[model samples]
Target: MKDGGINFISFSVGRYGVLKTFSEQDMESLLAAYLKEHPDALERMHFVMLHPFRDDDDEMSRSAREIHHVAKRMKFFQDYVARNPYDSTILINNPTPRSKLYLDFVHYVAALLGPIGSYEIFK
Candidate 1:
């Protein structure tokens, strides 16, 4: 179920049916668990998240850029996600302006480079 204007992962609930928000600790724990299962997960993560951009269009370079933008937006987005995690409804504390600006910046970048994630140029 899409909410707001972004896709979200499913939310986990705590005791008494309260939804659980993603936390740094939880992310770390999940990473640790994944590393426990796959010892080379750190290298894999670096390959995806920190790999250099390529001149040609490729999934790997696109993945890296996506991760970069996602990390950049996380500064404001993490708070929004923490509000309800999976809830996409309008928030009491909305960062709509920031989000709008960010979207515009994305479009600017897209025009400079190329379309991303189904965006089409208006003119």
Candidate 2:
């Protein structure tokens, strides 16, 4: 498939959420494709994680306990970090979210992820 004068596809890593289910090989293929398509992607690529906002516990959001399980298990995560050529900062989301503020933050991140008219977050 060719671009056909259309710009499509982008990837900026974030909390795995459902992606935690993806096998390491699957992730490798995805990153490989992204990098191949966007040689300059490292300049815009990112990986975000919330330290204490893990609402996944008690089934809240999947329990913050495993917030980084996938990244830790996957060696590719480390490779990305090591080869990152851009200057990206890690967001420090408040452990206790403030509604408006939290929503704003969510919106800001959604924009950075480059969603279309609408996008589904996670299952």
lDDT (CA) per prediction: 0.40, 0.35
For model 1, state the Cα shift of residue 110 in Å: 23
Q: What value does the lDDT take at residue 9 in candidate 2? A: 31
RMSD of 2: 15.5
Candidate 1 least-lDDT 10 residues: 14-23
Q: Candidate 2 at residue 43, lDDT?
A: 32
Model 1 residue 103 CA deviation (Å) reads 17
The C-alpha local distance difference test score for the whole of candidate 2 amounts to: 0.35
Candidate 2 lDDT score at position 93: 38
State which candidate has the highest TM-score: 1
Pairs in steric clash, model 1: none
Poorly placed runs, candidate 1 (over 4 Å): 1-21, 55-123
lDDT of 2 at 101: 20
lDDT of predicted model 1: 0.40
